[model samples]
Target: MPAGEVRLVFCNAPDRDCAERIARALVEQGLAACANLLPDCLSIYAWQGQVEHAHETPMLIKTTAVRLPEVIGLIQALHPYEVPEIIALPVTEGLPAYLQWVRGQTLPLDKSA
Candidate 1:
């Protein structure tokens, strides 16, 4: 069953410090309820028409649809690379209590921002 109770955003950073900074920014900005940082990840991809490889940390950010755009803009402004990967997945199924908690944590996004 499609819950549509929450949203999951996948974000990656070059290292722990970068991930931490991003996480803090999201939380402080009332964007994410929680974020998990996984480090020591090896990634290989094509960038600038060349193959690139690097160690990175991935973050699983839990938030709501209302705050998504702000999250994207913040990441783009803060990320060091020219292009960053930021993908969002709808939470099809989740415990209702947890989903509610996520909603409670993120404040309503201002339309003017």
Candidate 2:
């Protein structure tokens, strides 16, 4: 894979509905090729100096690095949390064909220029 061509974006939502909505939006907008939502995760963290625990859905978004900014922006807009976690990790190694498919899926269908 080309350097920075692929990335795995991580985000957390308060509930399953929110996770599904966010994931669908991202994939529909071509910001992500796919999103795998993991539900019923217990997240324990500190916020505003208080320890908090909540059930969260963790979404793994697959997309290109080129589309990361737009992905983050969309997640921020749609997420309900005051500080939604959005992080991206570069995909250094993967099956070549799958990586290519991700690149292709993220491109706009209308290629006219």
lDDT of 1 at 22: 91
Q: Estimate candidate 2's RMSD in Å.
A: 2.2
**Who wins the lDDT comparison?**
2
Q: Show the lowest summed lDDT stretch of 10 residues, model 1.
A: 1-10
Residue range 1-113, candidate 1, lDDT tens digits: 22234789998898889989999999988888999998569999998899999999999999888778888999888888678889999887878899989988886755899
Off by over 4 Å in 1: 1-5, 109-113
Quote model 2's TM-score: 0.91
Per-model lDDT: 0.86, 0.90
Listed per model in order, the count of residue pairs whose N, CA or C atoms clash below 3 Å is: 1, 0
